[model samples]
Target: MAVLTTTVLRLEKSRRTTKKLKDNVVAYGFLAGGLICFGLFSWYPAFRALVLAFQQTNSVDEPTWVGLENFRLLFGDPEFVAAWRNTFYFTGLALVIGFLVPFALAVLLNELRHAKAFFRLAVYLPVMIPPVVTALLWKWFYDPGPGLFNEVLRFLHLPTSDWTNSTNTALISLVLVATWANLGGTVLIYLAALQGIPGELYEAAELDGASVWQRIRHVTIPQTRFVMLMLLLLQIVATMQVFTEPYIMTGGGPEDATITVLYLIYKYAFVYLDYGSACALSAMLLAFLGVFSALYLRLTREAT
Candidate 1:
């Protein structure tokens, strides 16, 4: 009787072990599918691009290893330097305008007592619109003749100015469009961060006779610093890759004033059929962004 009982317990244990192993295999099988997809679509492309950066290739002929020749040609090009400068300038402008507007809008929205949902929806509506559509809409808005913006100015008896037509205004006009279109999502994120802040902190600030701006400076900013920093990094990285706006709006026009690194990359790859140069430029951008992110995160982590 004892031997039979022990044998029954052993069989049950064996069955449980087999079930656990089967479950793990099933989970790993699903995970493997996702890994395979990423390997094919993401990792492989990145690796291929990196390899092509060092090799002369048109995707037809056998690629010849050129080793830094593409990069040398890239650096020698005046437009390459101009693209970097323009990208940095755009990033700075975006940080100044795009970075602040969303936070301010979020704060205003958070303070409103009624119709909060309506305001939030209004703020986020632009985000739902396709980026290409947004760019097209802004292109019309920036048109000098019979454009909505110029019309508004004329209606107010103000002088109509060149928007995307002149080099002076072209880059900044695109910046404005980008800020308006992208600010919606940033505002919503700030709003979420604001909501997560403990209400009691605001109450304490009020009790201490802190004014609105003071409360925001002393309490709100500190609480949301992490979110702000993260968004700052993301914004810089994103603005550095400003392609769509230039592509759709300015086409890197007005003497290449609005040309950015990514747009230049596009020109290299598609227009000039210089895939090697394009890949080299992409590698440079990737390296810069990777280093910047790492350093920024380390500094921010230490500060916090």
Candidate 2:
């Protein structure tokens, strides 16, 4: 009886081991497929760009190595400086306006007990529209004479300003369009994070005589600090690479007030037909973003 029992146990253990191995094999197969796709679509292009950054190539001729020349040219170009300045400025303004607005909207939506679904849908509707279409729609609204905004201003007997045609306001105008189009996703993210907070914390704060602002500062902000930090980093990165709005709306016009690094890259590659310089500019942006990401992760990890 003891021998029979031992044989049965051994058979069961072997079967379980085989099943586990088979499951792992299947999981790893799926993972390998994803990795292969990423390699072909993402990693390969990045590697090619890096290599091309140091080599002069027009895709038809044999490439010649020219280390640092492309970068030197970029540094000497006045447009490069302008592009970086505009990018940094846009990022700062976005942090000031775009960053806070979504959070505020999310909080307000959270507080609403009535028509919650309808409001969320409205907030997120812009996000569902394609970015190109959003740019076109806002472009029409920004038209100087018959634009929707100018018409409304005229109706109110208020002065009409050139929204995208003036150097002073062109960047900010693009920023507004960007904020409205991109904020929906951020609001929804913040809403989800808000919903995950413990209700008990809010109750405790209320019991302690905390006002609405105090509760938000003490309880809500602290609870969502991680999400906020991550979004801040993402927002900075995204704004720095802003291209679509400036590309379609301003065309980097009003004396290049709206030119950004990515738009510059597009000009280099497509308009100027300087693939090497374009790749070099892309490399610079990549390096900056990479360092920023690493530093951010390191700091956040230490904080956590």
Candidate 3:
């Protein structure tokens, strides 16, 4: 009996040691691989972009040092300024509408019981389509006369604007398409978050005579504040890079209204072969995003 007990103890010890060895191997392997990959693909390329921002090149051998000339030129150029304005406009619109709409939709979806899963799937279905495909589909829908959008408006005796070609409506039309593609994923995420909230919290609020607005304001909003902030920051950064829609749909017209920072960089590097200026523009956008991320982190830290 004593021998059997000793044998069992020894086996348990052996198993523990084996587990520790396996864990160590996995942890070290992950750390080493992560560091190597980050250094090779992310860190090195980031520093290289900073270097390229200060140097002049056309994708050939050793770029010449140009000091801050690229940045100077980027700032002084009227087209660059217009792109910057467009970028901010898109960012603001996306941040305001994108985050809020998804949150509101998610809350409404949470109230749904029958076909809840179906509704969730429906909300996220559009995001499954590729952005370029979504852009193309929206472009067809915006066609002046025969497009479904215009046809619907005409059927309703409402005015049908020439969406993508009209200087007045082109940007808004592109925004609507982008929103349709993006809204799904945001809604899904928000739905998950809302469902995670305890029913007890709502019940408690109700017991306290809290109105719907008060419950949302004091409970829902507070509960989801971190997620909301993070998504807002991500949307702002992502929207500032609006490119594919305008590229494939409007070609940065009517009158350059939709030319964004990323579109400008594409024109600089590919069309004009101005590698240095493209890198410089990329660097500026990177700086803005970095500042935004840092500020968001700081705000979240303070809140916590």
lDDT, each prediction: 0.95, 0.95, 0.88
What would the per-residue lDDT of candidate 2 be over residues 1-304, giving only the tens digit for each residue? 9999999999999999999999999999999999999999999999999998998887578889999999999999999999999999999998899999999999999999999999999999999999999999999999998999999999999999999999999999999999999989999999999999999999999999999999999999999999999999999999989999999999998899999999999999999888999999999999999999999989898544
Candidate 3 vs. true structure, TM-score: 0.88
In model 1, pairs of residues that clash are none
Q: Least accurate stretch of 10 residues (summed lDDT) in model 1? A: 295-304
Model 3 agreement with the true structure over 1-304: per-residue lDDT tens digits: 9999999999999999999999999999989988999899999988888898999889666799999999998988888988998888877777667778889998899888799889888989999998889988999899997999999999999998899998788888888888889998898888777878899999999999999999999998888877787787788878988999989999888898888899999998899888889999999999988998898789788554
Pick by TM-score: which candidate is best? Answer: 1
- Any idea how many clashes model 3 has? 0
Alpha-carbon TM-score of each model against the true structure: 0.96, 0.95, 0.88
Model 2 weakest 10-residue run by lDDT: 295-304
Could you tell me which residue pairs clash in candidate 3? none
* Model 3: residue 270 alpha-carbon error in angstroms: 0.5
Q: For candidate 3, what is the lDDT?
A: 0.88
